[model samples]
Target chain A: MSEMKWGWPVIGAALFLLSAFIPLIADGYWMSIAVTIAMYTALATSWALFSGPTHYISLASGAFFGIGGYLVATAMSDYDLSFWLMLVVAPLVSALVAALIGFATLRLSGVYFVIFTLGLAEMIRNLVSWVQNNFLGSRGLYVLTDFTEAHIYWMLLVVCLVIFVFGWWLSRSRLGFALKIIGNDEEVAKHVGINTALAKVLVFTTTGFFGALVGVIIAPRYSYIEPNQVFSPELSFMVVIMALLGGAHRLWGPLVGVIPFALVWETITIAFPNSTTFFLGLAFLFIVYFIPHGFAGLIEKHWLRLRS
Target chain B: MDILVSGFLLAGTYALIAMGLNLQYGVARIMNLANGEMIVLGALAAFWAFTSYQISPLLTLFLAAPLSFIGNWLIYKFLLRPLVKRAKNQGQLEVDSILATFGISFALVGIMVSIHGEYFTYSFLANPIEVLGSTVAENRLVAFFIALAIGLVLYLWLNHTRAGTSVRAVAVNADSARLVGINVDKVSALTFALGGAIATVGGVLISTFITLDASIGVIFTMKALIIVIMGGVGDIRGAIIAALILGIVETGVATLVDPGLTLVAAYFIFLLVLLFRPQGLFGRRST
Candidate 1:
């Protein structure tokens, strides 16, 4: 089902490694930007993994990401756990939540599913809001990080690589095939003997795992962590936009979408911070209406036309 | 007693908003992610009219509703119609429409924010009137009555009017309606217009009670969406009941606990409903 040739994976591996060298060349500012790019790349990749295949536009990434953040923040704040321990536990925690939510939400179709996923995130955020208000006394959680920006960049890089490789592998996996078939036609997929619900849940769980894992690692960078900041709907919209803007169907599509968006995000932050969200919405409209296939597909189409 | 009356009034206002969404989603089968934008646009109209011409928001409802109606008619005719036509299947259409309307929502919100800045509040009558031994804002009572009047009018239009029959027919089966010489496209456009008009009135009502801003639309978006689903996708009566439950719950939570949890109550109900009753409280059970 992956249908990827050997050459593409080889190229992807080389390009990924080249990205790791950014910290060596760039200063701290650029290093920070690069790290953000890597984080979004990982997010977009995981998002594409689930949503691209199933066509189930998920709005719960922010919730999962926040869950990861709060989980690690609580651990550090209360239990004083090591960052390394969270490297394993955070994703697992997120996966559990995803599994629970996916069980109920996976049955929803179309717009109901989208709204529910969004509401799911909001519900979690509110739950966290309650916990923070009642138990934590409305004070923000803080974590100690001895690592420099470069270390953070490398951590993000490693996570991004793991996601990309897994995505590459999944493209060829049985589950991936099942998801694609379900995406094309759920009834047909069932008729063909695939468990559509199971495949959908797996996609949701896997994506949730990465989304939270990244949040666990990234939370230490921010000194103060609050539920509202981590669990905003805008964050969910960001990853979904990146995945959709790239050709979600392809492994590298998210990367294509992420690189440009991350760069634009950097520039826009410096130039006009408030307008970027608006612009992101405008960009979504243009891409969905004009170029639904995304940049990767646009390139493929052009190449195909030329060859023909 | 006061809480009950206040909650019922709040419920009435919510029904006005949710009913429009029902018309659009149930009858026209358009999710209209920009549904909140229509409401916001109505608020903006009222605010603008009030500021420039010294018109009362209650009086400016006429201005806001028609403008929103025309604005949504244009959106449906020009933007949504073409893209919807191009979609291959229901799934494809759903995602595309969500994205497109989302885009419109952003563009409109952005324009409003840049022009007016994010924060806004339109003040109305401050004097509290006693209603059945409970002191309530006059604006709230008026808003409740207006919402109730419109809801009744909409129900009558759907049940009695020829256009209402056509809308119901289109909702039941678009192809069948089209085959029977009902103009499905026109009904859809009219539904969007009607939805826009009613949502605008809801916005006008809320602005009377609360400080209106560009971001408030996001809150209404979540609330209306939850009410629509909790009531059953396209059932108007269900939408009203669900709206009342949510409005009461939200106000009760705000009164008893934290005001912030008002939205939290909405999310809680939405999740509980989805988990136990996916078809919604009032919707027919579907496999």
Candidate 2:
């Protein structure tokens, strides 16, 4: 193991501890912001697993997240399933759905892939809204549980840590290398006997799993899951922004990207409540243009230069 | 019969929208993700001009189209050109174009939401004309004619004109076109400008019939993309035919099924087309 690689886990552990203790030191409003940042980090990291490695942009992360939230709500409310079971089942179902989508659409590349996923997401969102309105008789599902904010926070922290470690491992593993090779050149990877299609499908499905997992965690925290709020295009846009801002392929990039993004979002929404979308949109554009590597990329480059 | 006629008209509108995107994507090979935002800009500009100045809808197109063309040209020259240069340097024009265009799209949406509040705005210059014992809005009829005229003009220009041949040559292969003494960059810029102009006209037409909101362009963009895909990329004739078919299908479904499900259905069809014929109905397979 390289000494430089050790820094990631060290930083991650420190961040986990800092995030857990932040609520204790901060007030309710600040805690709420922290929670939001943590949520985005989880979601963005989940997205990075697919987009960063395989370079297959799945614009349906928000859809999977929404599906997970809805599944948990339904399981708890209608089926009386335990919270733990909901967590496991929700992501599993999302992964299965993502696999189906991947099987159909992942063959296309670049803009075509983006367009197909965007269409699929819209279709799923419409379907969900239709079901919620017609059958559920509610625009959103609400959770009625004895769970406290602290319990939810702790649950999020554990999940985030597990996801981070998994992401770290994936980035270092042979599968990770195969994904990178495919991203760089599929023909060459295939020439060398890598099953490019299977690798892409696996990454796509796994990313959906984590996205849904984050959704399950966040739904209980908010205690509500609405089709519009959960399956928003804006949410998908924000996750892509987060991953891009942090450096798409970097582990811990999402964490680094999410903290600043969430903070800016919170601050902007507080100050310009009505016009926050405009600012966020502008910020996304600015980051994409000027800071292509995002905040994490900037830090990594500068830090490496300084160290060297 | 009404569904058929209306569908054809609606498809004409979609063709206008997809024409610009087709030029940008098919001919220029630029993966412009921000195509939808440009349509929004056009629609908003026309709407604002009509609301604020009470300009005639016809006159508004004259004003809006030029402005959108100039604005998009400037964006390509200043913002997108640099990225294209970088892509050339890296030997990966397609990937870089996708990233740059994605950024531009996000920025455009932001600027739009900032300038035009999220509320839906209706076009003020409204007049209807009767045709075949059916009431067709004058603006819709005018928009349709303008779109048809533009499409015809583009086809004629591309097929019969010297500059059009040069643009097609460049689309076929930039390096070879350059070797043959064609000014590839100029052709690309012109094609991009043409696309911008077409989208602007589409924006004006669409706003006349539907409510104009900050987000409406995205839906239009999606529809245009679907049309382009269905029509087969790079085949202008196919795009035209496919646009009409899609418009009729969408309108018929909206008439028969839930209006909201219309887009879902259209998207479902797009997936089916992609699965069965990935190159699109008329698109050539990429070599």
Candidate 3:
């Protein structure tokens, strides 16, 4: 109804349009990198939807992502399931897993909660890797169906748009306010009669759902799934970096964070492959120390100052 | 009998690592994600010293401890101190610490890789000592005793000294400690130095058992986390007991189950304990 309220969606639409033309304008190598940035943006934004608001850090995003990939791989390879069914089933399975884990561990807070989720992720990764190695008789799973990269690009675009809309809606909803209260001060929230534990569980499950959705879409594009790539700590680290670098608690933080990081990583990896981590480390330190508010924060502050 | 001997020896080394984490997380209340990188640094430093100078591994521990302590002190002075001061303004120092430490860990891994290459480097003193009808490698056994001595010294220093009281007071409440005329920053620096020293000892012992590599620190860091969690935060005696329990359980599990399953099982145990006793085995419930 209000002009200001419609601005976010308009921006989202413009970005989507810009992304649709990226593959056409860019070379194959850049296109591939662009695709990665898009995937990480989706994952990071989905993760930030819960963590940025609630402060319940789930170190298990990689596990959910891996589960989604494995689900698609197994469905396609073992059962001859269609790509469409794999995408639906994978996210649903991941959501259910998240619900169970959340119910079990949502009561803990701070460092304990973090370590618990991390442990759960590690367990799931090991279980999946063991199954792939022992039961499947392979170190990784490959997609049987032939699919083009363009198909993946379009699919990810659609999925990312859906998630973005979902995030925007959630951030404005009553539930988001409840999460904000719990994040700021749980004891005060409990005193005010908010169901703090339930809210946390719900947010965790929702985050897992979106993360798994991204994983399902990307699995076919890669045409293969390995436990290392799917369930590595690097995935979790990347998401955190994206969220923090883009300005946690902002809607478009992930997009701002993931795109630049992906670009820099791609460029540096090509020039000096072994030194990428060193450079990334230096960049990370600089961002944490000097640019604590990240890019989005800078944007928000400058915009407010200009208005004032 | 052999299992018992090995378990005790391993427990001693683990105690050293857990003590380092305990000092940082417990005493300073600063969760250093780069704690493992400090261990890696100490190990690599000792490795370099041994290979280049042909020094005995025993002497390297003494040499490495101060180096690691100074390195970590610098991290606190340059990197962490400024962030801590800005905590009131930022309101996200915890998250910042995690990111900064993660960066440090990555940087350390890169440095190690560049210096030592990707291949595992084995450095051991070629000797064994027969004790209690079991043959213990000389380096490992000596490292174990040295770790025990360090642990004792730390325990006494923390319990029976005036400076230790100031450190404990600051850990409880920095503002109140300042009100009571305690120098909180100096105490924090001392705690960091002590933690670094302990980590260096752990590195020395760990290097004796396995070949040194860049990625080795992460696992050890995780294991130390498990030990500290199981032991109870801010409780040194509890850490010693917990380390022994973990050492026995891990050694037994490795011997019985697949060696690869050790971390999975330990983490599972951690999850289980957290579900029931979130404060840990010996930690007091917070107000």
Best candidate per lDDT, number?
Answer: 1
**Candidate 2 CAPRI classification by DockQ:** acceptable
Q: Report the C-alpha lDDT of model 2 over B173-270, residue by residue, as the tens digit.
A: 88899999998777787788779888888887777776767765667777888888888877888898889878888878877766777778788778
Cα lDDT of all candidates, in order?
0.84, 0.77, 0.77
Ranking by TM-score: 1, 3, 2
Task: Tell me which of candidates 1 and 2 scores higher on DockQ.
Answer: 1
**TM-score of chain A, model number 2:** 0.92
Q: Model 2, residue A30: what's the lDDT?
A: 73
User: Per-residue lDDT tens digits of candidate 1, residues B54-163?
Assistant: 78988989877888889889989998888768988878888888888888888888877876775556668857999999999988888899999999998999999998
> What 10-residue stretch in candidate 2 chain B is worst by lDDT?
B87-96
Task: Give the chain B TM-score achieved by candidate 2.
Answer: 0.92
Q: In model 1, which residue pairs have backbone atoms overlapping below 3 Å?
A: A2-A171
Model 3 agreement with the true structure over A132-196: per-residue lDDT tens digits: 67667774577755656666777778878887888778887878888899888888989999998
Ranking 2 against 3 by DockQ, winner: 3
TM-score of A-chain in each prediction? 0.95, 0.92, 0.92
TM-score for the first chain in candidate 3 comes to 0.92
| Residue A20 lDDT (model 1) | 78
RMSD of 1: 2.0
